[model samples]
Target: MLTHFERSLVEALRPLPDHRLTAIVEVARLSPPERREVFDKFGNAGYPILYQEHFANLRDIGPWLFCSGKYTSLQGQYNFHHGLSKATGDTPISWLTSALEPSRLARHLGEAATASGPDGSTHLLRFYNEQAFPILHSRQDLPGIDHLLVPIHSWWLRDAELDRDDGEKGWRRYEGKDRADCCGVPPIHLDQACWDALTGDGSSQRLADLLGSLPGAPAIESYYPNWLAQVRSLLAKGRRLGLKQQADLDEFVLFLSLHANPLRGSAKLEAAFNAAFKDAVDGNQPLAQALKQRLPPRLLTSQSNV
Candidate 1:
């Protein structure tokens, strides 16, 4: 059950402005401390209800599939960061299993496969399945994500209650004008900013300030201390917390809380770019060489940091 504080946080965190997508995209690309702060603030604790509902639905798909998205345009930003691409068939699943045995495979793929719509455009499907997941999960490794797909539909829905016959598909066959708003692009990492904003390099001071004034603020006051402490502990230890520990922790916060508008920012975009390039090069993944050629400066920057 959600505590009163959690409920309050959820209420405050909702209704994010679409323009914040630029800030989120910018921060998600940066490094640790920065990335962690971003995740903790925007993506983790401050995520909207649509995302929480979306993730809850994915749980029904079992441990292998993890779904995430937002109602706002931020979804588009996520798509760009994660590189919208498709990987049909078993190739994606096979790669996932091979990456780590099912037991070791802690990552779940988010699918947003959309179908073609009227006017030759695509209509984002309101629903998707395991088969469609792998195709879209290949992008945005910074969020420790695998793939994503947008399922499209032909019809639409204007309201929840429709006057349809019992034998036909419920609300699935509405005309173009009646079609409901279909699910669009799924956000790559919903919790990255929340995590960073909470625990990244210079975040503690801000968190402290927010905590003091959080009485009627978002849910940040409710779980900020405990959550921030745990993250700080992890960062202090700096042990092998896994490849994308910050991203994982951020996701955890979003999964557990119901904050309406905790915090959001775009301070880690460069770091995301760095991590993506490194993953491609060091891991020798599919797009490493090509990415290397495109972002030669990122490679040079990494070497300089060392």
Candidate 2:
């Protein structure tokens, strides 16, 4: 009892290579009732089959996908929790709902594109899922064949305290000074150039060179603006106006001044950090009050702010 769109999507997927189809079947092995719910909820819309790829050996800190399209924007990178859930095999339907929701997807893409590194590299890998796979696969003129479902995995090497040199050939472990940990501390020591390369165009090539020179897998971290951090802190700690907090507030005010449309920017920023604010104010009246104080008077009084 599929709709026309659903039927079209299924027909598209029917011709996929056996391996690719098998993977989809494995991930989507829902019960009949659950299948009906999924079909009913998502019948009209396309689904985003998420994918991830690392630059250099930075593990999971690379760009990700929310859908498979030639023009997939950088903002399509999977959120932290979504990536973590996918990595750990805990993906829920709610997670999928949030990801595929059009408004939420647009907001996320906007934030990611705006906050991208200096090179402005917002392009991400594209992949096929049940919804998109059929459409893309049907096109005979698709540019790349290997752009299909290729799984990626990452592992971090840990330091071992003991070095055991077994007598077997190629079986030697180093210990003490001789034993070096394969995984070192996070790559918090990235120079400005490195940061530029990571966030810039051709980031993958840059990452490969960087990782080639490093001893262990580099741990990548997300960058947040100072004002955003301050707002977040105020929301979390409640109305504690220390010198640092005051400075953060001042910076936030400066940010507002710089933007031509402060209201729009504020709304986008709120959407970007929605999860954090939700966590901070959950069952915490003091934190909520602190957040209210930090917000502009206009925002507080404006019904359009929401």
After superposition, the stretches of candidate 2 with alpha carbons farther than 4 Å from their true spots are: 1-88, 91-104, 107-116, 119-306
lDDT on C-alpha atoms for all candidate structures: 0.28, 0.27
lDDT (Cα, tens digit) per residue for candidate 2, span 164-197: 2442111111111111111111111222332322
lDDT of 2 at 116: 23
lDDT for each residue of candidate 1 in 126-206, tens digit (9 for 90 to 100): 222222221122222323122321111111111112223442211212111111122223433423332333224453434
Using lDDT as the measure, which candidate wins? 1
